[model samples]
Target: MELTPRLAGMVALLAFLPVVAFGVFRTWWAGAITLVNVVIIAVSLYLLMSPTESEAHAAHGDDVESAGDEAL
Candidate 1:
């Protein structure tokens, strides 16, 4: 399965729900933790949005042939 930004966001948000619920039922600072978790999830999702340079290059078929040619 290919991991994508939307998938990562969905997964992280799902994982965070329990923590948010627990925090709500616990202390105030515990509730504050929900915000921190959200920020982390957002950043992770943002990063996942783009494939790295090598990954992008590999996705295109041309690079693989060029690489093989160079090895000869």
Candidate 2:
């Protein structure tokens, strides 16, 4: 399955909304669960939004391969 960046970000924010509301309402247990949910959402958002190291490596791998070829 695929999600657009904007949709993913919005989902992340929505996932945290209940926690924020629970905290404001002083519902401790619900707030705690919400906080956990928020953390999970945050990590998911970061992972989704950030570029993977593999992509960088792939981009630079050609240069490294060319250098090795020159040395041969």
Candidate 3:
């Protein structure tokens, strides 16, 4: 089955929730470390998957330098 972004997110949440929950219940330090690790992983994944600013402009046929200069 193809893993769409939404599905992937759900899968990741499911996979982490149990371990994090267990850690949290066991001790403060474990909970903090696990939570921080999860946040870092999620952010890294997001940055890697998202398109760069130039790529987004190119995809929409917009001039990269002029993207923010349009009149409101």
Per residue, candidate 2 scores C-alpha lDDT tens digits across 1-72 of 767655676777776676777777987887888788777876788677767887766667677665675568
Query: Cα deviation of 31 in candidate 3 (Å)?
Result: 1.6
Per-residue lDDT of 29 in model 2 = 83
Clashing pairs in 3: none
Name the better of 1 and 2 by TM-score.
Answer: 2
- Relative to the true structure, candidate 2 has a C-alpha RMSD (angstroms) of 4.5
Question: Rank by lDDT, descending?
Answer: 1, 2, 3
Highest lDDT, which number? 1
Candidate 2 stretches with Cα past 4 Å from truth are 1-18, 64-72
Identify the runs in model 1 with alpha carbons over 4 angstroms from their true place: 53-72
Task: Tell me the tens digit of each residue's lDDT in model 1 across 11-60.
Answer: 76776767777777888687677768787977778686867877876667
The TM-score ranking, best first, is: 3, 2, 1
- Over 1-72, each residue of candidate 3 has an lDDT whose tens digit, in order, gives 865545555555664776677686798777778777776776666566556887776677566566665443
